[model samples]
Structure formats: C-alpha cells, structure tokens
Target: MEKIEKFEIYQRRFLGNKLKVMPLIEKIIESEIKNFNSFCDIFAGTGTVGWYFNKENLQIITNDLLYSNYIPLRAFLSDEEFDEKKIEELLKEFNSIKDCEDNYVSINFGNKYFCNNNARIIGEVRERIHKYFLNDIINPKEKAILLTSLLYAMDKIANTVGHYDAYRNIKDIPYKPLKFLMPDIDKRKNQNNLIFNMDANILIREIECDVLYIDPPYNSRQYSDTYHLPENIIRWEKPELHGKAMKFDRSTLKSKYSSKEAAKAFADLIENAKCKYILFSYNNMANKGHSRSNARISDEEIMEILSKKGRVKIYEKEHKEFTTGKSKRGDNKERIFFVKVKK
Candidate 1:
C-alpha cells in the first residue's frame, strides 16, 4: 500500500457543486472582468470556487453558515500555521485505534448514517481532536485540518447518496474503516485569505470585493439539514436529535433563500452588495422537479432584481444535475448571470 495523494478538497460529492462548471465560470470572469484584486464566494458550499481563484496576488474571501463548511474553508484558504509531521503521526494513531467506547456518533448515528464500527471510530477521533485543541496541543489550523480530514473520510463512507438527508437500507453495511488523508493545501499562495461562518445576506453588507460570486441554494433543500451528520460531528454539542434522519435543532441554520422568501432575500443581498461585478450561479430547473425541489427564485425574478444593479449578461452551459430522490432534473443547464454593478 503506497501513500496516495487522493485527498483533494474538491473530491466530495456535494450537491449543486460548481466543480464541473468551474472552467466556464473562470472563462467568463477572465474574459469579461479585469483589474480585480479580491474574489468573494459569499455562499461557498465546498469552498471550491474561492480556492480555484486563489492566486498569490488576489485575496480570497469565503463564507458558509455551517461549521463543517467553515472549518474546511479555514483549513484550506486561511494562512494559519500547522505542523505537518504532527498531523501525519496523529492520523496514523487514529487509524490504528481498535477499541473505542460508545459515544455520540456510535449511540445516535451508528448503523444509520454510517456503519457501527466506523461510527465508533468517528466518535473516538472527533473526541481526541476536540481534546487536543482544548489542551493547546494543536493549533487552530491543525485542528481544522484534522477535522476536515475526518469529514472528507466520512463523506466517502457514508451510506447516503451524496448528502445526509437519508440513508440507504443496507442491513449489513460493509466494514470500510475510516482512514484519514492530508488535504492538498496550497501553502504558498494568498496568505491574506479570509474565512467566515456567517449568514450570506448579513455578510453581503459588511464586505466589499472586486468580484462577488454568489452560489446560493437553488431549491427548498437546506444544506444544514442535508449535512447535519457532519455538522454534529464538527460542532460536537451532542444535542438531542430527532426524526428518522437523526437531525438536531437547526432552526437558526436554515437559509431564507431556500424558503418562499427567496426572491426577497436575493433582492436584499443585491441591494447592499458593494462590488464592481456580480457572478451569480443558478440553474434552469425552475419547473423541472417537484414543488419542493423546484427553483425558489424564478428566472424572471432573478433578471428583474439584477437588472437594476447594472449591465447583465447570461452564460449557459449544459451539465448533469444532482438530485436526491425521484425528482427529475431533465436537461439541466447552469446559468451564470454576470452583472457589472453600477458605479
């Protein structure tokens, strides 16, 4: 078994991820926008777009509401110092642990989201990471890296399709032991990058960037509910969970963009945005899926809201859609609304 470099930050199978359309996005920005210094991914899901545009001369700002996402943002983009050898040693130690007592994950999420043995290991490793951080044995960046490694590893082995909304009915889930891998972080570029765990609408007014990239949830599916398992593991609050999905109280984490008030939220966000350019990523699933899975903001509403800002241009690319259930997303085409904000 050779040491493989397989842990890239973009490897996760995240729904509505911009991994495939990244090239189209970059092409539009490079061709149209010029003399830009900062790129802000206000609703960065996996932090893929921000990291893709991370250049030595450009500043990167990424924000997400979930701690699971924010930790990875800090781990990959922030210029915090971390010990490499210590991290490698800790991974080896965690992988070798055979005896782990019953903990939150094992007790609550075992056999549902993950297999029992892997769930126990997850609990044990998360506890150790928390203890190490509290005891000052590891720096914040190191802790983030470790937690991110655990998250990526768990995402690989989870019994869900692409998100934790529901799990498949596998009576005897295979014994795929959790293995940690070091994230491929670019250490030498854009040391001034900033990371935040704040609401995107509130954050829009506080920050200014040359290029503001917006990729909000397109449907009623809230990311917090979808990724609750990872959120619980990262926050480690061990709160009371309910429902068949084993979800904790996420009242505060729900985004209005995923609700009926999506058009209003988009309007407010655009009204306060202080940027030279706005790049909005949306899809043509307005009427494709079920009522809950349909696009919250219609194309007409999006056009009307953005037209008031400045000149708007639309870019379309045919891409495959990611769905959770029987909902059909036929003939999906990602649309990027490029707006040059009025000065």
Candidate 2:
C-alpha cells in the first residue's frame, strides 16, 4: 500500500453533492448575512456544506435520515474529544487486516457491489469496528471516524456508476484491495456542533440557527434507493436482500421532499423554521427527464411557501446535475432562494 495522506469527505462521488458550488453558497451567505455564528444544514446529504462551514469556525448543526451520512457528519463535525494519535494507530491496523471472513457483506454483495475479496474484507473490518466500540476500545466519536474511513474506501472501489442502484454486468468484477485512510478533519475540537439522524421536516421545528440551509432532494429519486448499498453497510442490520439491485427494505428513510408531497412538506418546513435567514437550494430541472427524474416541487409553490416567511432574493449559477445514466441532460441552473426571516 502506498503512503496515503488523508481522505477529504468531498473526494467521494456522491449524488447531489455540493462540492463544486460550495464557493457560490459561501459567497451568497457571506454577502447576505452580516453576522451569524451558527449554520444549520437540515438536509445535509453528504455533510459537504456543514463540514465546509465547520472549517470556518461556525457552529454547525447537521441532520440526515441515513446513518451513512450521519456517521460521516459526526466524524467531520462532532466536537467530542478524540485521541488523534490512537485513531492514526487504529487506521494502520485496519488497513493491515488480511484474513477475510465470509459474512453479511460478502454473502450478499460479493461480486455485485464489490469484488469477493474486498467484500469479505469489508465485512471483517466492520465486525472488528463494532467489536472495538462494544468493548470500550473506542468512543462513539472515534467509532464514527473509523466507520467513515471504511465508507469512503468502499465508495472508491464499488463496481457501479458512482451509485449503488446497480452493478456492472461482467464475468469478473474489478479487484481493488480494501484500505482505510484518515478522514481529513481538524484535530482540534470543533465548537458547538450537533449531529442528527432524523427526518428533515420533523427536525426543522426543533432546531434553530442563524442560517438554515435547505438542500432537499429536488427530484423523485430517493437517496435510500440510490445509496442503499452504503446504507446497508453503515447500518449493518443484515436484513434480507431483494431484487437485482440487492437492496434491503428502506421504507422509513424515504423523504417526502422527493415525492408529490414536496410542496406541502416544503411549506411546513418553512412555516416551522426558526432562523434569521433561509437558504434553499433547488435546481431548474423541472419536467426535463422521465417522470421519476422530474422535479416534484414547482417554482411557483416554492416562491409561495417562502414568501410567507420573509423577503426572498434569488441567486443562480449554471450547474450540471448528477445522473445515473437515465435522466436526460439539458440546461440546468442551481438556484438558491435566500430569504430574510420575519421576526
């Protein structure tokens, strides 16, 4: 294995990741708000926005339904104290693991989402991680950091088109040895950071911050379906797998924002939000692709819901959307609806 430095959370290929437009988002917030000490990313998919702001020393509160996203968010943004030197030593041990065991990941996902060898190793590593946590070898924060490293490593070597919807059909899947890298995060404890694995709409009412950034799913695609493999690995429930895609039941994790109820959900979220400013990210890809790929909430509905809250200003930047080789590509612009909340 080569001497790798560290893995940035943005390095992983995630659907709807805000890595490219992060600068634009920062600019909009910086220009609009004069003073804000806390930022809440309620629909923090990859924790990209929340993690980015954490670097700037703003108190960050992040919420996502999936444990896959929650674990990484905790790793990157949690202020809990951890031993960096011990974590580094554990990374070396996790990477040096050789003996592969036939376990849930190997039996269900072998030769599909991952190669046989890597799949077995993945199961082995996950089991070890749980054992480490169970026996008090690592704290919750430390466990998150370790699990995050495994998740990123799996994403890199998965045999799919940047998602877990389906794997490529071939006689032999590509074999890449499973390895862990240190998650690129500050060793110093971040201040006043909070993490949640909860539904965004329900969560919005309970949380308050200076800036509430909402980047809900724009289309009908459920993140649980798109990233189910990662969810399965992160949860480790080992439930029954179904279909060629090898997904477990994820009914509870579905977001209403991705359904026909998007407008209603958005309205409720806005009505209950307690914040000085609202930054809503929605793309102009309505009715552009197949029915499932089309945007659920309409522009009129968004404006109507937001107008009741406060004065709204719109910002636009042309950006390409991530597709799973199904949706049609066209002129798309990611729009941010910035609103000054009425006190």
Candidate 3:
C-alpha cells in the first residue's frame, strides 16, 4: 500500500465511512495506463486516478465541480516548479493569525467539529491563502499546493462521520499530520495540468484523452449536504450564512445527477467520451437502477447503452468493512464498467 499511502488524502477521506470501490479503480488503472499515453478524469474527485499517470510523463486532464479539487490536481499532477520560502512565510503568518480571529472559518463550522480550534485555524488559513490566489498576489502553483495541503490538514482534524454533520459521539482523538496541513507551503503553484471548475454536463467529444475515469455520485445523497461546512470553509466566501452554513440553493442536487434523465445523460456522455477506454465507478445503491431513486440499474441496461459505441467488460468487488447486518451488506458489492474502443 506504499503507493496508495502517498495519496494520504484519499484514505483519510474515507476515515470512518465506506468506500470499497477504490481498490477496483486501482486494478483497472494499473492495467489500462500500461498502454495509454494520457488520461482524462472526468469527475476527478480527489484526483486519485490521475496520480497514476504522473510517473509516465503523461498529460492528465482533470475536471471537477469543486474548486477545492482543482488545487491538488494543479499542484501534484501538473506543476513542476515551486517557491518554498514564500509558502513557509505564509504558513507562519497563518499560524500566527490562526487564533486571533474567527471570521468565516468559525462561522461555518466551529460548533460542528469537536476540534473547534481545528475549524477556526483552517478557516483563517484557507482565506489568507485564497486572498493570495485570487489577487495574483503569489505564485499560482504555490497557492495551489498550500491550499491543497491545508485541505488535507483540516480534513485530518475534522470529526463527525467523515462529512459535516456534528459529531454526536465525542472521541478524544487528536488530528495527526498537523505539520503537513499547516505546512511550510510553496509560493509558486504548478500549472502543467489543465484544471477547471464546472458542471459535469459541459464535458463533450472535444476533450480528448486515452482514458476517462468517471466517479459521479451513485445515489441521491448530495455531497454538499454532507460536507457543507467544508464547502464554505474552502470557498471562504462566507456567503449569507444559514442553518449550519448549508448553501442548499447552490447545491447540485441528487436530481441533477441521480435521475432517469441523468442515467441517459451519463450514457450519452460516456459514448461521446473522447478516449479509447472509459471506466465508470458506481455502486448498487438505492435508485442506481432505471426505475427509481436509489433504485439499482441492471447490467443489461448499461450494456445495451454501450454496445453500439464500443466493447464492454464488467467487474465486481465486495466492499470492505461493510456492516454485517444482512440489510446493510446486501448493497455493498460495488460494480465497475469498463467500456473501450479501438482508436
């Protein structure tokens, strides 16, 4: 797990929650990247799939809806140069000012997390870093790396069931990797990779690459709902705050990506994917099927959609640490769809 460990944020992200499909993703990527020259991670959550190509000197194009994700993709996967001293200075300044003021950080999640200090420090630091990023006050690559590191750090400190809900169970645990989170950041951000913050629907045939890895949310449960505080913390905008800082109006609801229309749209999007190989990561959750929300879709429906466009193969792996209760583990077996065509 050495290589996997290097992607620390990926594992930290699933702290107490369940995410069994990550290993299957590793398997397919290991096999596919062996022959590919470039990759396009359409829904690049955490940009873990793109990391596999970095060693090959291959170009990786990553797109995500959250600006928070763009920072890491640009820093680790794309950029080459950096300014260590400036980042260190920023880090020092951030820590020095961390406890002085609460501002947007505390307003968003001070009460939800057990580590109130963690949320407060993270908010202040994120805002300061973004100020440098937005005003072109510092090197873009440096800002990206700093913000990315901070995100990792803050996530480490956050409590609750992985997302933004208040921790009902109080655990006397300390956030490790504090040094990495509040790091001696760089001043110059790497810009070798192309990154964008946009709705997933905008992707089309024009974006070309050797492989496309799609990991859109499978169920109606929205990420914004679970991770609302961080959304505000990362954005640092502190928009008219509401109940628990949830910007519900701005959320890309489950209807947008979990509807019958969404399934057809996903098929159309995949068929038009400008890649030789396309891998879709999804689980048999409620509504995953064609009939209803959280309703699992059948393989036949998926195969029929892809048959006309390319060759299709299927794989399945049981999720790790699934609840033993018969009702819980029933839907834990996740499935992967590998659709490829000769280019």
Candidate 4:
C-alpha cells in the first residue's frame, strides 16, 4: 500500500503552488479559529489542502480548472468507500489490454511525447477504460479513479522534464514499461464532499463555507499549457493541435491571475468570497530580479485587496521556486494571508 503523498510526488516536481505550509495553516486554525465545519479550496490544484481538512473531519468542496486535477479530487474527497479487491481486479483487467495499432495518442503523439509502441499502448489502455465506462462496467467514481491512475502512470513514463511543454529528443527518451497504481484514497467515512471543474472566480459565488482557500496561478505560465498532455488524456478530446507542443485549444481555460488583470481578479475574489475566513497562498517572486520575475500580482496589491475585506494577518516562509534550469534563485518566499471576514 503506497502512501497518499506519492500522488503528489510528480506534481511537486513541476507545479509551484503546493500547500507546503499546511502545518502552519493548522496551527493558525487551532489558535484563532472559532468555528470551522467546512472548507472550500477554490484553486484546488492537487487537492492537497482539501485532503488535509477532509482528514480533520471537515467537509471539503474543491474546484479546479483542469479535468486532470478534478479526477483525483473526486476520488479522494468522496465519502464512498471502494473495495480494494475490486479495484485490484479492475487494474489487472486494464493492464491485460493488448496494445492496438492506430489509436488517438499513437496516431497523434507517436514519436513526439512517447515512443510509437508506448503511445499505441497508451491509446489502447485509454480506449479500454472508456469502453468500460460507457458499458456500465464501472461506476462514475470507479472510472475517475482508473483514469486518474492511468494519467499518473503515463506521467511517470513521459519523456519530458516534468511538464508537457516539450519532449526530449528521440535518442534521449526513456524506454520503460507503463504501470498504474491505485491512488491512496482515504477509506474513512466523510461528510458529503463536492468537486467542480470550473474557474475559481466563478465557483466562489455559488458556495459558502467556513474557510475558503485560494492558490491561483502565480505567473504567465498557464497550467493548461504546462500539463496539456495529461489534460488531453483525461478529456480524451482529440482536438486539432498546433506548434511543436501539440497543444489543443485552451482559450477558455486562461486565468486572469496570469495576466495584467491579476490584481483586480484577486480583489474580486476576496470581495466575493462567501466564507468566514479566506486563506490565500501566494509567493514573493515579484520582489526578485526581473529574470526570475514570474509573479503577476505584487505584494502591495495583495495586501491592499486583502486588507479591505477583513482583518488580515500575513505569514511568510522561505521556499525554493521552480525553474527550468535557466533563472537564478531570487529570494523566494511563500506567503499566506489569513483574512477574517467582517460580520
């Protein structure tokens, strides 16, 4: 039985905005919190923070723009318990699926993201999973678990540094067999949890919880651009692709936090947050040199927006920023702003 943290291992390698300060968050919640029964993770990237609260007996409502991320959130946050034997049998059935020629990934991604044979195998596995889903061989949750497992497996063997931006040259590509692992989902009974695949700004309006956690994109790097391959896999949408990256049309998934409107967007989120306490996780990359200038929102803007909504207390911790082996480390610090909303 692998640990639940293994699910986040691959993501931590690339994704920058992970909740590494969860212990600090818990400490704050214990010290200043009056009453907290539910939590809403508006920018639930990998559902790490949501899972943390869920374990502490709080009902979790999590949302993310990426379907790839939503899959794991659905699997982990749901109260339904799955049979280990059933899941194991299903994995065996999926792994037994023979590689077929000329499928979606093989035809499109062959010799690009993976070797031709591996791509064909990936296509074969994905097609089989969908077939099981359509034929009612598996329930919706079961399907999500399987698909997420496959996505994680594919990510391990992908021929890239971490993201799907570019693949390694043919000669450098690793030749390893694809494998899947059942996600370390919590089996304990929980209160009904909700999961959504929508923009954070849009989702904040419809739900009210005791705590709202926001960890939006910190820079111009659109997550859809970085993890497009996994998105394509989970969506199974074989849309027209462009450039050397083979990326699909992601016009609708762009975040305001990654553009010139970031400050306004942050302000809007704080103003509209229908929660008692809003805990925001952002970094201090804007203070660094221009070469390491990835942050779209400045420190002053964050304080200005958060202070207007409630009594804001800021916490900071030193952390390393993720880079592509190009930029120098500029004083990186992850900050958390706890806003106690005015009644």
Candidate 5:
C-alpha cells in the first residue's frame, strides 16, 4: 500500500469541533485590527487551530486537559528540528516489536473496544514506548512523537465511529495491522512555543498572549470521559477502570465546562485572559433536540460574560454536526465571538 501524504489524517479522526472554522478564524484575525506576536489556544483539542496559526509565524501556546492531546502538541509545536532519518529509525524500531500477551490495553480492553489481537498489539507497543522512555533511549520530544504515532495508528483501527464510548457489535472484527507513521513536524520554528496538560481555568491565569482562542466543550460531555482510552494510552499508568465504558478514575480531569458551573468558568477565563483580542468558537446546539441538548451555558449567557470584558462582535456560519444515535440532523450554526479587550 502507498503512504498517505495528508498531514491532518489523524486530526481529521478526532471527535470534536476542529479545523472547520479555520477560514472564518483567519478572516476574523485579518479584520479584527490585530498586531499579534503570540497566539494561545486555551482549549487545544488536537492542536489543529494552534498549528494553523504557528505556520503563520506566531509563537504558539497550546493547552489541553487530555494527555493524549499533549503528546501531539509537543511533537508538532516543538522549536527543535527533528531529523527524518531519526524519526524513521524510531518508527522502524517501534514496528519491529512483536505483539505480546496480556498487556494493559489487551487485558482490559480486549474483545471490548478492540479485538484481542489488536488490543495485544496496542499493549505491547505502549510497553515498548514506555520502556524506551524509562531507559532514556529517546528524548522527551522523541517519546512524544513515537507515542503520538502509536495513538494515531490505534485510532485508525478503532471499532468505534470517532470516540471510544462503545465498540461496534461485529462477530468478526476487522483485523487491520497497526503501522506508525512520522508526524509532519513543524520545521518553521518559533522559540517560544509551549504546550501544557492542565485545566484551562488554571492555565489561563499564568499565560499571557496577544491572541487567545477559546474552544471549550459546548455541552455536558466531558472530554476525559469521551477519550478515556486514548488518555489511558498516553498516561500508561494502568489505572483502575470502571463501568461499561471501562473508564478510569477521571475525577481530577473533569471540566467545569461540563457542569452547572460552566457560565462562571467561562466568565473567569475571559477575566483572566491577558490578550488584546479574544476569539471564542461555540456552536448553537443547545436548542437542538438531541441527547446532548443539555448545554452547559446558553448563547445569551456567553454573550453576557464576554460583553462585560470588551467590545464583542459575533460571526455565524452553518455547520453540519456529526452526531450518532437517534439524533436528527438539523440546522447547525457555529458562532465565533471576536472580542477587543477593554484597556
């Protein structure tokens, strides 16, 4: 089989609002009367938007609660140049590891999310990557790149649609062999590039940038719950899981964005953001009759919070939401709030 050249193949598989609003964001950036040197993605899900800005010579700072997301951010946003030969050699070594029996993912998730064979392979590969890190064989950036490769590879062959909530009920699951690929490293280096794996609320207080882009969860769905399997693979701590979804204890990873406190959290973020301009991407999915109709904050609430901080302008574009179950497709619109902070 021929190799795919698309840089966003893995990112396209991510389960969230990403990449779709880039053109609109770019337009906003151009028109918003900005002179920005540093860009911050406070809720960098897959680092897609931040990476987009990084290419435009902005010093990028990306933060996410999920450990899985941090891996890719570290790999893509690093200032250091990576040798293609070294990356290829690392991939070769990772692929060469034989699938072992009863590894963490295999023992817990075998015959559940992935088939036993694939699960075993995931476990073995994870172990090898962990071992490489422990033995100091690979540097921190190299470890991130290799782990990100494995994460993307596993995502490709996952039996679910995009998330790890449930696996498809199939008698004979498709056995696609896992293959690691080199991530498209951003060579246009910015010395101040930073990545963080912390709660957005806490992180916002410490970082100050010229442009702050906020893309928090719109509904009551916690990302840690949705992407638990990937998080597990990233942390590699062999956590104690529970319930039908086989989720680990994510008590520490829960976001206020998914709770009744969401409005307050949004307000706090806006207050704490040290930026000239703030852009927020949110969807009008609250009134849409769906399982996730329980939106954390209303549009009016969001507008009210943001208005207190600055002069705000709203942009709207129709978007097709990817949903499952008995959710009917309807008119979906993504709203971007461009705010000029009050000096």
Candidate 6:
C-alpha cells in the first residue's frame, strides 16, 4: 500500500506548532485497531493524531492541561453542531466594537500588545467570540472552530516573532484577518470519548485503553511558549505579562513536562497507564534537556524502561524540517518505540 497523509498539519502550521513524524504511528496501530473499540490520547496537543486515527467508528479520548490547548481540542473533537450563519452574525457584531486607540487593540487587562489596528481587530473579534460562548447558540465543534479561527487570525496578525517567543521584532501592524479564517470543521464522531484537564502522568493511572499513543515534548521546548499568545487570546483573560507583552506565568514558568522530570516522570506515566500496548514518538537528540540546558532523558534512558514493558519494535523516519542543517534534521532518527503489555 502507498503512504497517504491523513491530515495537513505541517502545511497549516509550519512556522509554529511542529508535529512529530506520524506514519510510523499509523503503521504501528494499523494492525491493532480491531482489538480496541476506544482510544485515549494523553497529550492530544492539536488533535492531529486523535482526529486522524478516528476512523473505524471508535471513541477517542483527548486531553491537555492548558485551557488554551483544551479549548481547541474540545472544539475539534467534541460532539457539537456548527451553525455557520450564527457565527457570521456574531463576527459582524464583534468587529463593530470601537478600538481603544486608532491602532490600539484591547488584550488582557486592556493592555495593548500589537499595533493599534491589529489589537483593535483582535479585541473586537474576541469580544464577539466571548458573546457566542455566553449565548450558547451552537455546539462544541462550532466553539472549536471559533477558537481555531481566532488563533489562526492571531498567528497572522500577531506582532511577536514566529514560534511565539516574543514581540520584540513585531513592532508594527499585520495583515488583515479574512472572514473565513477558520471556515468549518467536521465534527468528530466521538462515541464514548473523554477529555481531560490534568497532567499526562496523573491521568495515565486511571485511564485504560487497548492502545496508548505518547508523543511527548521531545526537547525542553515548552509548548506554552510556542503558542502562548493564541492561548491567551482564547482564554480571553488578561494575564500579567513579563516581557514582550505575553502572559507572564506561561512565558516565565517551568513545566515538569519540560524535561525537568521527563525521564522518571514519563517512565512512571507509561508504567502506570493501564493499557495493553504503548507507542512513544520521540527523536534521538544529543541535546535533550532543552535549547539552552542539559540532557535529562537520553535515548538509552527511554529504551531501557520501554524494553521492560514488552518486546520493543522500532522504526525511524526523517524529520521533514528542522532548524539544524543535518539531512535527517535535528536527530538522525525520529524513533517510534512500541511496547506491548500482555492481555
């Protein structure tokens, strides 16, 4: 059979929101789908893996700790109807709101981040989005689309640098937001599904499924930093910002998920998760701790723990893009490690 791409994740989110190589994952689970009627994704990031695997009429469980992450996933995967006309109407009302300044847009706390025009547009749209949620006129899919559209708009108009590091370079206005930024999304046929707002480690113990898919943060690149602005916009709550006009807590904080405890923590999560099979998606990087830090979990470290679980099967593929100039990209191999627990 030929390899086919299920979702266009990379094309849609190239500069930010990088994803792990997924074909190996598709192949690993291709044979096992029949045995399991329910699926659970602990780190359901953008729902790329869960949404793609949502064939066979099986229920999919998706989770993420951040409110921003949870909102988008919930919007995408939940059982909700999407009403286009109503959303359009809401947008009309939102864009009518007055700008605080000619170029000023209202962010959290009425503090301005972008140029007045960008902020004004974002502020107006955000107001209407909040109204939509309050009126409760539509379902979860609609909500997700609303959230997604806003994020996409934010990405284009945001003054910050790519990958959401800071706004130091974005010293001016941005391109205008198109009306159909989010368009419409197909509602996931999520039968018997679950969504969670907890840590990956904590949830592993309680959830049980035939297959568990783990694509954790490869290095210490905290996810919060990469997409922090969109998260803030969706949260619709102004947070204290440290520098470059982003949420202080998110930008300045450390994630236990940030390889601060990745090795022991992930091993524990995998060990305790009451699942028959486990597949981990990570690359073999010499620099593991973080961009400017040391290694926390090495290639040997992970293989050791997963080895104890079952007879491990490994497949590696090239990372299509990376900052490094290497042919294989950041790591020589984007490793897929599969372990099966006896039923």
Per-prediction TM-score to the true structure, in the order listed: 0.97, 0.96, 0.79, 0.92, 0.94, 0.81
Sorted on TM-score, best first, the list reads 1, 2, 5, 4, 6, 3
Each candidate: what lDDT? 0.90, 0.88, 0.60, 0.79, 0.82, 0.63
User: Considering only N, C-alpha and C atoms within 3 Å, which residue pairs clash in candidate 1?
Assistant: none
Across 57-154, the per-residue lDDT of candidate 1 in tens digits comes to: 78999999999999999988998898887888888878788877899899998898888989999999999999999999999999999999999999
Please, what are the lDDT tens digits per residue for candidate 3 over residues 14-80? Answer: 3112234557777876775557767777777676666544544566787767666666766666555
Using lDDT as the measure, name the better of candidate 2 and candidate 3: 2
Candidate 6 lDDT over 45-93, as tens digits, reads 7667777767546877778766666776665666665676666655554
Which ten-residue region of model 3 has the weakest summed lDDT? 1-10
Error of 2 at 88 (Å): 1.9
Model 2: per-residue Cα lDDT over 210-322, one tens digit each: 99999999888899999999899889888998999889999998889888899998899999999999999999888787777778899999899999988889999999887
Error of 6 at 73 (Å): 1.1
Error of 1 at 269 (Å): 0.7
**RMSD of every prediction:** 1.5, 1.7, 5.2, 2.8, 2.2, 5.6
Residue range with the least summed lDDT across 10 consecutive positions in model 2: 1-10
State how far residue 181 of model 4 sits from its true place (Å): 1.2
Candidate 5, 1-343: lDDT as tens digits: 2342324423547766577878889889998855689999999988888888785467899989889888888988877555567667768766666657787888898887888888998888888778877997777888887888888888888888888877777777878777788788756664679889998989988999988999998888788888999999889999898987789999998899988899999999898888888899888888776646556789889889999879789998887776775677578888898898998
Per-residue lDDT over 172-264 for candidate 4, one digit per residue giving the tens place of the 0 to 100 score: 455777776777776563467888999878887888999888889988888888888888888987789888888899988788888899899
TM-score of 4: 0.92
* Clashes found in each candidate (C-alpha, N, C closer than 3 A): 0, 0, 18, 0, 0, 7
Whole-model lDDT, model 4: 0.79
